[model samples]
Target: MQQWQRQKKASPKSQLKVTFLGEAGVDTGALRKEFLTEMLSEIERKLFVCNGDGKGKNPVYCLNSLDQKYFRIAGEIMSVSLAHGGPPPSFLREWCFQYLCSGDADHLQVCTSDVLDMEMSLLIAKVNDATEDSITDLTDEIINCGYTGVVSLEKKDRIVRAIVLHYTMRVLPMLDQLRKGLQLYDLLVLMEKYPDICLPLFVPVHSDDRVNSTFIMENCKTLFSEKGSVRRRQECG
Candidate 1:
């Protein structure tokens, strides 16, 4: 009877929880660096496969025009990195290679279209006349709509979902800042100064609310009350 029970237990499947490298409550900096390194290396390998070895000799005329275009973009990005005296930023590398992967043009286009649609939504919202309360609510509604769209896409398409999520998280906050009366040029400069505004979006699989709330709490000071800011400043001081 004991042997039979053991066999039965062994036969039944068990659930396995797979954790990605940068999940919450873990030290992710080193892991992210490693992931970026591997990603860049993979991209370089694919580029060599598409365009020829990085030698001065002309590559074989083999890749299709689309493939060639991807290679050119990747090459130009690297050139920019070299001119700046370092490797390209992690996000830029990931974004470029994401489309560079063969057999993914449709996915790339879909992701791009989704982002453009979200931008159009923001623009329309900005153009509409509204009071302070309505504008603030509209900003939140638009962001939530975009967030929900990406979350839905995640069920079927992780790559496109990730691309859209990254863009939405990065740009929508800036739009909110603009809605709060920050000048467009100032917002652009702030974006440049703080390029990692959407870094939390890359946190490994978690609930939509958890990810969204964590990002907003960490990145947005406008969400805090004046009293909260005063307390925090007093504490820090």
Candidate 2:
């Protein structure tokens, strides 16, 4: 029985949790450094990391892209994330090849050239008034400037369900509109539909509300009121 148990322990059905080194508690600089450290830690498990600037650009963690055969050669997978900021920094790109993916031939990376902060709903919204030229320009902006990406995000939310009522009078696009409702929440929910994108780059922001919101994302202000922001929030709820 003992031997059987030991064998079972070594079975392929084992899972492990790893800290990808993001902001320890809300300190932006510390978060970057922490994540950098995790990137340097043990290289035995599969890693998925999200890279974003404190807010505007994608923060990135890559092994290598220079030598395209990294995945073919490296044993461990290193998934790079860019789900938040517009474009991840170039240094991260350079370093992916120079360090993570090169000398340590044990790692590989996954990359997609998309701004970390795109929403399907928002994209749909842009279709009405935006031209094809505008869309292409937007994509280019996202890739080139980095966080400087020209994301064509206009009225990101819509009350489609409410509009489809029997007695509900259909309203024209520009003619009828709700005042500032769930602008950021809708955007985030839309972004979250892409799990592949959010995994590696899940950075927690600070807020006084019980629920998190982009409107009050104070990455640096974890504890604003003496009442203890997060704690007080929980207590009140």
Q: Which one is best on lDDT?
A: 1
Compared to the true structure, candidate 1 yields what TM-score?
0.19
lDDT of 1 by residue, 1-237 (tens): 122234444321222122355575442344434433443455444432221222111112223523334433333333222222233323222222222222133444333333434444353434244444444444454454453432222232432354455554443322232222222113223333343553222212223543232343367565333665887777656
The positional error of residue 67 in candidate 2, measured at the CA in angstroms, is: 2.8
Candidate 2 least-lDDT 10 residues: 173-182
Best by TM-score: 1
Provide the overall lDDT of each model, using Cα atoms, as 2-decimal numbers. 0.35, 0.28
User: What is the lDDT for 161 in model 2?
Assistant: 18
Predictions: Cα RMSD each? 22.1, 19.9
Worst 10 residues of 1 by lDDT: 51-60
Sequence-dependent TM-score of model 2? 0.17
74 Cα displacement, candidate 2 (Å): 10
